[model samples]
Target chain A: MDRKMSPETRSALEKLADWFRARSIWMLHYCTGCGAVELPPSMTSRFDMERFGIGPMATPRQADVLLITGYLATKTLRRVIYTYEQMQTPKYVIGFGSCTINGGIYYDSYNVITRLDLYLPVDIYIAGCMPRPEAILTAFNKLREMIEKGEANGWKRYEENKEWYRANQLKALNGEVYVTR
Target chain B: MNLKELISELKNKYRVLDEKFNDPNHTFVSIVPDQLHAALGELKSYGWKHLSTISCVDWIDDNEFELVYHLWNWDSRSQISLKTRISRSNPHFPTIMHIFPTAKYYERDIHEFFGVEFDGNSEMEPLFLEFWDDIPPMRKDFDPLKYSREKFGERDYKVPFADFIVEEGDQK
Candidate 1:
């Protein structure tokens, strides 16, 4: 007997899952640059990030979203990959500043990885050198909407194309060259 | 004694290549590399004890590395920048760790960036760049842009005209 779920039933189940995911979001933010400063104001009484049911978590394993605050230097990117992999499925990556989008002022930096999307699947990007608390609130609201619509599928994308992302990471990180004067 | 008297005494001992009073409080004294250590020691004895910073300037045209040792006198409330030019081919300078212990980190920084070896400092390993595997980045010969391109692959950029809105007056 072939027991296949009907189209309507499957769609309804997905919508329920999306609703639950949208309501409870645990974030692990790596404060690598100046953009980390804006978070304190937003998370505090002034902006109140907790109102959206999005709160910070210490460990990656307990988190659903990885918040990359700013620039990912070659070294920090290595650690980020380790943390990202440790996270459970249905994970999201929120790229915080212009640094994560295109390396910001460190665009010409030898060690700074420019385009973050090449390495990690970014669910949402809040642009600006350091996006204000208001902008941060707006971006989070947009992210929730994306979640509700079953659109924030970065973790699924990561799973589907794991090999390509790994190759890019290795190319950027693993190398031993001649260091001379 | 005073700054003038101290510099006059130093002129009698060391080869003063050039001397300039840049500002009311800042004085620069350029000297040969051979007498750098001895001159610095005498200056320390004359209450010029504070080591402000150690900086390096690459003179690729002259094929030399200029090492500047910035010192401060608390009593006189003035700064003295002792400058010395060393051969670029054999870029080595004696560490002034005996006079200024904090110079260890500064020497290591200079060693990492400029490829200038501080002979007396045993900890010659990198200070800032931990896993750096390239030529001294601060040198004029080492092209940072080329190095960055080689190490970090850039994005294949194209014009995204669809995202832009040109104003009617600006278009003309």
Candidate 2:
């Protein structure tokens, strides 16, 4: 007996899944740089990010979002790749501050990487040296909106362009990052 | 013994090339590389018991490497910087671990950054910089900008307008 559901019913179920995913987002509590200073206020009663169902998770296994807070040195980038690979699918990456966009003040630094998008797929970027708590909340709201509309699909893009990202990672990290999975 | 007596005793005992008193509490004594071990041991016996740190500087033009060992006397609050120079091409200095056992990590740090071989220190392995392939970065001749550009590429931008707009007065 064929137990396949109708196309309309499948689409409705997917819409419900997107709605749940957009509401509850568990961000990894990993601070890469100085940009992490703003997160305390955002998570506290002053801004109250929990009302929107976004909270910090201790482990990447339960996290839906990975926030690259600031500039990533060559050594840290390897660890960041390992962390990103450990995350389950449907994961989203938010590149915080101008450091992830270009290199910010560390443009000419020998150890700091210039661009983050070359290695990982970034869904949205918050532009500032160190964005305030309000800006961070605004970015979270925008990310929720994107998820609701099914527009933020960086995880899918990562799977499709795995080889290209791997090449860029090897080039920057001197072929040291080993992805166990 | 006071600073004056200490300086005279060091001069009479070891090969003290030059001595300069920065202030009453601080002093710098330059010595040959061969006399570093003996001088440091004597200084330790003279109540300068603390070996604060060991720092290295690359004198590229002179083709020499200057190693400064800062020793502190807690009793009198006086500090002495024992300085020594070794040939840049063949930089090797005996490890001061016998006199100051804490110098093992400092020697490893100097070896990692400046490429100076500290004899008798078996653990000269890299303290930092994982999988470092190029020359020592702290050396003056190693261009950091070139290395960064070659390994990690720069970002490209396409301007919507002209490359440069020159004002009438600013034009050469």
Candidate 3:
């Protein structure tokens, strides 16, 4: 049952892909680390995120994507979660760097939360201590595909397993997720 | 070139920008928490471009966390760093989110990290650290090392297996 599309069919597919890729994404404009210091250069004339219709938004209510720059602290986690919750449905999260993914430079420190996924559902996880602006743009493109396919809602699991997440949230020093056998 | 001229110009035109200090990279102007809005408005008129990056530093021993608004302009390769020290006890300040779109994120981050209240921030919740106390770490006195050592044990690492051959120095 292997059926390959013809040239005209492929051309239409390409056009659909381009349309999805061009969707405008508004950033919540949150930056919580030294990594955030690098964002201005990318959002400005250098990277020109506006060229793709991606721009910074004033409110989470209007954002299509939440970009967590780096190093989540516990107290900050509450606010990040709150804001993420406020965003309308059909949203995506882009974990900007290693710190957002796994606390790259701050792993040894317990005060900072290592994984951002624990707070909000992330669509594309870009890895690097401080990824270049190009990496961010690449992640945005990857997100467009995910958005079209609708796979970024993996966080639904958190809603489904509320007690499990709470238990993990309130766990003791082992940093363990579940309570016991 | 010197700070005096800049201070004089600002003082003459605007009644804001209190407690000015000369830092290596740029000038540090301490605006009283109340005057931040006016000061920012005046700065914006000169093409500050609303590059607001608000962050907090813990100064717990002093019962304060310094909230900084680092604004920059691409038009001119210069920046005017505005700072305000607020009491950690109440930890509230007027939200600059209205003046600059970028402040939405920056203020939300400060609110979450330091438990500092930005009166009208679009997002008042946390940013990075989710499971944390009201204790603000960036304050000069939050002692991250102490927090880490207490929460997690001493650093754990496997021993290195490489054996080095020592060579004597050519005469002590």
Q: For every model shown, what is its TM-score relative to the native structure?
A: 0.85, 0.89, 0.46
In model 2, the clashing pairs are none
Model 2, range A30-145, lDDT digits (tens) per residue? 58889999999999989999999999998889999999999999888888888888999789999999888888888877778888888998888898999998999999999998
lDDT of 2 by residue, B3-66 (tens): 8889998898888999999999999999988988888998899899999999998999999999
Those runs of model 1 whose alpha carbons end farther than 4 Å from true positions after fitting are A1-15, A174-181, B156-172
Using Cα atoms, each model's DockQ against the true complex is 0.43, 0.55, 0.12
Scored by DockQ, the top model is: 2
Clashing pairs in 1: none
Off by over 4 Å in 3: A1-22, A171-181, B1-172
TM-score for the second chain in candidate 3?
0.71
Prediction-by-prediction clash tally: 0, 0, 21
Candidate ranking under TM-score, highest first, comes to: 2, 1, 3
